[model samples]
Target: MTDRELDEILTTRWPAVMRRVIGDDSDDWMQGFVKSIARHSKRPSWRPSAKQAQLMQRLVADLSAPPEPAMELVER
Candidate 1:
């Protein structure tokens, strides 16, 4: 995809997914992932490689999946 499109995804779409995945907590891994993607997108020569695009798509899918159900203990 074009740099502009990537930038839009990174700026607009990704943050929403991040919020869903991590809530308000400071997740270092997520922060670093965003920073890395942003850095690449900002580079003059950068456009998302096919693998990068695929990875982003997978991440969105994974993050958007419903949260696992919590289990409760029962007292006898």
Candidate 2:
């Protein structure tokens, strides 16, 4: 994916979840975080590392999954 797409996913799409996991909700934290990741890229266009992308995709999937049903108590 492009750098902008990655930025969108990390910043716009899942800021709340990202902030919870990162424990830093300050302004522009996500933008700085994304820039740090993108800084290591060797490509002409910036992109997250494969591992980073995979991890983010997993987060998206986990977030998108339906919640499990609550178990009913069987009190005698």
Candidate 3:
């Protein structure tokens, strides 16, 4: 993948991370994770861990595949 694509991947995964670790998650854990990685990173880019990446990859594949129709389209 190109640098831009890599950045997009990281950008896109940000929401997935928050969804996984939503409310009741420890604040410090989130803050420190961001702060530590943020310090060295080029942007507020978020990269999922290996396991997370696998889950995200599967989620993406499942989403990418077209859904079966609830009912067939008919010609007018």
Winning candidate number (TM-score): 1
Please give the CA lDDT of all the candidate structures.
Answer: 0.71, 0.61, 0.52
Model 1 ranges with Cα > 4 A deviation: 1-8, 17-31, 73-76
lDDT for 57 in candidate 2 is 69
lDDT of 3 by residue, 1-76 (tens): 3456446545675445444434436477654553443344455555556664565455445545676779987999
Better of 1 and 3 by TM-score: 1
Candidate ranking (TM-score, best to worst): 1, 2, 3
Residues 1-76 of candidate 2 have per-residue lDDT tens digits of: 6668676775655655554445644358554654455455435565666887886666666667887999999999
Predict model 2's lDDT versus the native. 0.61
Clashing residue pairs found in predicted model 1: none
Worst 10 residues of 2 by lDDT: 34-43
Instruction: Measure candidate 2: CA RMSD.
Output: 6.6
What are the clash counts of all predictions, listed in order?
0, 0, 0
- After TM-score superposition, the amount by which residue 49's alpha carbon in candidate 3 deviates from its true location, in angstroms, is 0.8
